[model samples]
Target: MTVTEELVRKRAEHNEGEICSLEELALHQQDIEKIEFLNKNCKKLRILYLQNNLISRIENINRLKELEYLNLALNNIEIIENLEGCESLKKLELTVNFIGDLTSVENLVNLGTLEELYLIGNPCTDYTGYREYVIATLPQLKVLDGEEIGKSERITAFQNLSKHYKTILKSQEDYFYKRVCRFLSVNVQALEKVQAQQRRETFSKKLEENNGDIEKIAKEFWQEKGPYTPESRTETYEFLRLQKEQESQKAASFEETKPRRKIFFAEDGRPYNINEPKIEFKFYEEIMENEQYFVLDIAAYKNMDTSLIDCDVQTNYVRVTLRNKVFQMALPEEVHPDKSSVQRSRVTGRLLVRMPKVKSSSIIEPQNTKWKRTTGSVEKTESKDKMKGGKSNFLTVGETTASVDWRNITNAEDSRSGDLEMQKRAPVHRRKERENSPSFVDNPDVPPLE
Candidate 1:
């Protein structure tokens, strides 16, 4: 073991009651359980720095009840779990880590003492934006990464995000907004609007009961739901409910219809797989950078059906209308016709389709017309075939042309020649080549008289 490895098992002791230690445990590679020992041994561990190590678990430190400041930065931690009940974590440094989610960390809202957060190297490089996200989440993160909010560099970031939020709250911005919204996650705006409408209803009802003026009531309504607080909405309110509702309802309807999109089957009674390039299309509902429930891209199931298709399909060039919004999308189209696919999942676009089951159809015996007899077969052709003098096959018009043969052309040289052949054969409208065109063969390879 090295000196640093020995330091991990180090214990600071004294004859006094207790001693607080800001442990700087660094560069201990492949040591996942290093903090596990400290959690059990170090009773006075205040600020722990187990960064740049292989510390994969946070639950180890969760046992450190006195652990006020923890720096678990630069680790391979995927989930931010088990840090919920640790109400003493005033400062958290999660930089340079693979942590992508905040599942259980949201409940750390009660830790009102959280002041500074260093989430630099992790996915959250934009501390300003992530601060707001964590603000909305933890609601207690004030000083994020040694920077003060509502002042300094953070104010501009907040102002920009505030505008984005404003655009979402403003009138129906664009077609995409009616499809999916953004910054609010999936359909948060719709949920908030429902809540806001309820609050407005309650406020309006209270105002009526209190016999307040209509203008004051409107102002109060704004105050309750305005950008600022309930007390400041009087002068800063715009009654855009009707318009916002229309957009919100469109989004809600799309969302309501989205989860109902059944996957895993094709129309011909076959299980759908994601590998089917043609049949696979994305079912996307995005909240844009400045819009609510906006449809970024949409595709019809008819255009995405690949059951009848055989080969690889290249739909990289596709222009279609989705929920009245025109968008250029990339997906697969019919390329290879011989390849049969049972699962449809490869195509990524704006929607995925689960084709309806091919229900069995009852055989309809000759109801309209009886079949006519063939020459040597006991087959009955349709009566219409008698008028036409021949019976037709069930195959399509071009089924016989499936395989392509390279031979059997009139001229082999024409087939092998370059595209220059077509350019040469093109009509030039020239009367005579000798009179109009310059002859290279008539002149020698030597330079002409300058």
Candidate 2:
């Protein structure tokens, strides 16, 4: 039944003062949208059951400051918000919801008395190390998603959380890399071969920095490849250098056979080289607080003069030049070039480019896009079908006439191309410090004190 003052009074009368006030209410499966009627009526309410409803948000509950046990299971709630006033709540049921981020759980951690939290069947449960993350975040949580949090489990979760987080990041990186490769029409095998050579070169440089000390390098390699002798180390280094040289030669041969396209010049009159080294940076495009941003790091080129840095922003392309290094890529989304700003950090050498989004109602027309020029630029032509429909004329650069989706081309310049497994195996410098600290699982023979 719909929760009303009349219904609450009727129940109180029928129970012979047992339900003296609307202190406890069971309004399940009522399809109720608003509970404004219970604002002043349920002044002494401590328990509330509103499960199996169509409630999409947790609002209008600020008046329930005295509420302790709140059963909100089986609702359509997407975010864990609007519970700032529930300081007295101890047990909160939020199962079968759409909570996807762990930060939502962090928000609930502010409720110091929240001992029992049910969050099963939520989208966040599918996250890697979900249980461990929740356990680590809310140490006071005794029962989590119907499972009791043991002392040993808590210690293990805290110990392995960083490792699990790294795994999650690697998975995201792999997804982005695959998307980029598909957008660039680049063969995955060819990219992998190039990356392998780059890794070998990096290793060789590190070895040379150590003054070719085979004994010292052997100690570092022992953990990964078992014991290594000086002869084995020298042989391995030679093999890597040889393999890298061979890969470079093969790439050069392929480029020679391939028809080279003409170089495109930036709006600033600087010709962009197709064979130039790709910029060493990481970037992500995101929309925040009604504004779009293209954040990127250019710390690798810190030695370059800041005054020499030039940026040319267009609807479909963004060309950033720093001395000899140039970063030119097609933008993924249409943005207002007039509302963009570039800022460089002197300490970390990172660059932040803010691009405000255009109004949604504005119509964005596709611009004539060109890549590395081939033979020559041909005249714009229209077919019979294009003329009848009044479509844009196609521009021919080389022998092919096509309309390119420049947004997809932005993924080709990603610098983080390392394998996920290789990145996971990277040494953690803080691991030793964590191990030296006391833990509940330090002694297997003794039971946990908690």
Candidate 3:
């Protein structure tokens, strides 16, 4: 993949929406095949690390004049060049690369500030007189391949540079032939097929969502990528950039179009209740012993963080916010917000709110139910007809009788026996004159004479 402006800005540690303010940047192991955008944007960078990549050329970094350290180890770089603009460079690391050109070491002569140079594990390191040629050519280098160049070694390398010159030249020729054969043996078509496979795997999820429509996916992939040319890589990166921007714009549009809920007050100057989250809840008054409370239980989202939930309990209403969505309702009775307590169940994730009632109330009966009266007496009418052939037992009209017989008004079969039983249980000195009369056989209150 080629380095893009977005990638550079993201890798800038001190970047606060601007890349020029950055001093250090590390872009290692990102599979970057080409170097781009750093020279044009981050001109103030001091230290740069672009190691462990697929980069084959060193380019587009000549503008980093403030750069002091550069690390380009373990890449496909064959020759180190295009760093004449880094006047303040002190150390350079190019370890374990394919640098076969020993003559390219002379390029660092322009960077007079370079002190340490590392080229260990490179193709040029195995050449005859490689260390001597590097030390003699770059006089400013204090350390080479992790070893400090002593005064004696530097003097000896400069003296013998003439003798090893012909052998170094022969080795360079051999390496050139080897590099050509290596490139010739590689199958370009096979490498391209592998790259295409990787691209397919990258978009495999999109393919599955499209029901495995290869033709549609191919058309979409090559939408802006024009005919096969050297700039096809640049075209692919541009397409990705546009796709990301479009996604961001779509998200912003969705947020702008979402419906917003109004709480607190209605448009007509009345209190309003909103349940934007549509949470199911139960609000009721509970009477327990001497205490009464207004209980509200809401079925909030399960396993949600408590930090995302907010609650406010008022005298006659309640408001709960879940992840910014408001859920509010008016209470059936006034409550005390200060004395209210709220708890969340760990098992069911239910929010339970209990508010002390402002005015305690008892259980009220239904308005439509009727009740029997407990006060006042009931009067009854007395019969006027007299018993046949018997003296009047009931009192006559306007006559003030001293006593009246209650057995005459009772049922005939139960009067005598029932009254006798009651008279036996009654207090002593009660009247027995009626019992002494001679109408015992005819009296209906009397039991059978047999």
Candidate 4:
């Protein structure tokens, strides 16, 4: 039966006060859909019996400040809430109801004067050590589920609770570590594929929600996941966005700290020399008048003396050594080994080499030649005289020419017959003119005129 004014009047008559001043109200099993009328006329009421009713909420009781005893047993209530203002409450009965977890007990902890609490026949009671947990949580309770609590029981319950929580935390940590390792071990390509598929699905869902408006979807996607305000949308969305950002940051940090492996690619014919200390040097080449010149900048070896520098030059290769470093390079073309020159600059620490071009008629021969000790010497080979059948004599000033037949000048007849015949005739005329003249030619080997 629903609670009516006649029922309220009948219940008030059994109490020790008038209808308006009644301190106790037993309206159990009355199918009360609401408690609005109770707070309007029952201002002085302290004890409220709301058991076995259709009430699904524990609200609208805040105006009953002096309320001490509240019986909400055997109701359809799904959550325990909105009882914060019942400051004078000492006993609360919530037995045989739909409360599912001990999380609801947290709200009741604010009841400072509460000493008795009953939660029997609730689903939360099915959990192991639920009674101990409740007692440890609500230390002010003298009786829990009709059982009296003692000091020793409270201490034992607290110890068990601490151990249980520590075990849970450790298990969670281990599970998380294992999951991280597994995630890292998965192939990156596969993971990226999965992520792409998930993004596609999310995009499809959003497109449907926005009536396939691509522009609207794009705008929504690019919008800042948020600087959340009190008026922002669902808390779950905010939480997920923050979680995604944190995960991205963690991934970026991991990549930053991760070590990179060094890779070297070797050419088909060129193998890296492990024994050689890696040093970079500059190379230059020039060609001039049948010669090739090369200069190597070995400035890194500036600290070494000239004597410590070593070089080997060949017809088609060169090898240099300085301190602990060695460099070997193959010449691009064949060169004349006998005419090649190698020198090092003391002031600039540069290595200069000249390799003459090999003549077409000559064969290049390999020679294991080392650099000469002299710093600036150029090696060259002199060519022999080319004229055949011609004997040339060196003549000094005031020396007489040797007598010879002018007709025997076969090669000179074609090129210089007139000039030679004039020379032959002029010498005779010079002798006669000299003899007739008074002044004589003065010579150390000749007798002076008397």
lDDT of 3 by residue, 1-450 (tens): 888878887776466756878888889977688999888988988999999777888999999999999999978788889998899999999997788888988888999999999999887899889998899999999999999999999999999998778888899999888655544556755665677677657667775686544455556687644332223433465545555665676678789998776547767744577888888998777665567887889999998998999999987788899998998887777788998999999889999999888787774532332332223522232233423455434323444555657756566586477777788898897666555566545658878768
Give the candidate order by descending lDDT. Answer: 3, 2, 4, 1
On residues 1-450, what C-alpha lDDT tens digit does candidate 1 reach at each position?
A: 122324654423232322235333333333343454555555556666666555555665566566678777766564576766566778888776644443335556666777777766554342234555554555456776666655444444545655434443332234224324532464766765676678768766865685443445556544553332211222222344333554576677788787432443457644333332333335323222322221212233545444433222222223333332333333222212122122333553234322111222233343345543345434434555344546443322333524546664435467556566677899898676555455446558779888
Superposed model 2: Cα runs more than 4 Å off: 1-20, 163-450
Which 10 consecutive residues of model 2 have the lowest summed lDDT?
226-235
The count of backbone overlaps in candidate 1 is 40
lDDT tens digits by residue: candidate 2, 1-450: 245666565545534544435567777765554455565667677888888765666777767778899988876676687776778888999987655545567677778888899988876676678788778878888999888899999999899888776665554456446545643555755765576577568667766786453445454544554222222333444554555665676678787897644456778855453424455666565556656566555554667678877877776567777665567666566677897878888876766777665544332322334232235775554444446566766466566667678766535355553454467899877634444645545668888688
Residue 118's C-alpha lDDT in candidate 4?
90
How much lDDT does each candidate structure score?
0.47, 0.66, 0.79, 0.65
> Model 1: residues >4 Å from true position, as ranges?
1-30, 102-104, 126-129, 151-450
Most lDDT-accurate candidate: 3
User: What TM-score does each of the candidates earn?
Assistant: 0.30, 0.35, 0.48, 0.35
Estimate candidate 1's alpha-carbon lDDT, on a 0 to 1 scale. Answer: 0.47
lDDT tens digits, residues 1-450, model 4? 345667788778776436677888888866565666666677777898988765667877877778899998877565678878888888999877756536567787888888999988765666566777778777889999888998999999888986554544454456446545544566844774676567668877875786544555556555737322211222323334444665676678888998642321256543233225455666555455545555444444555787776776666666666764566666565566677777777676666666665533333322333222223443222222532356434333343457666667556546687777678888453434435466766569987679
Clashes of 3: 0
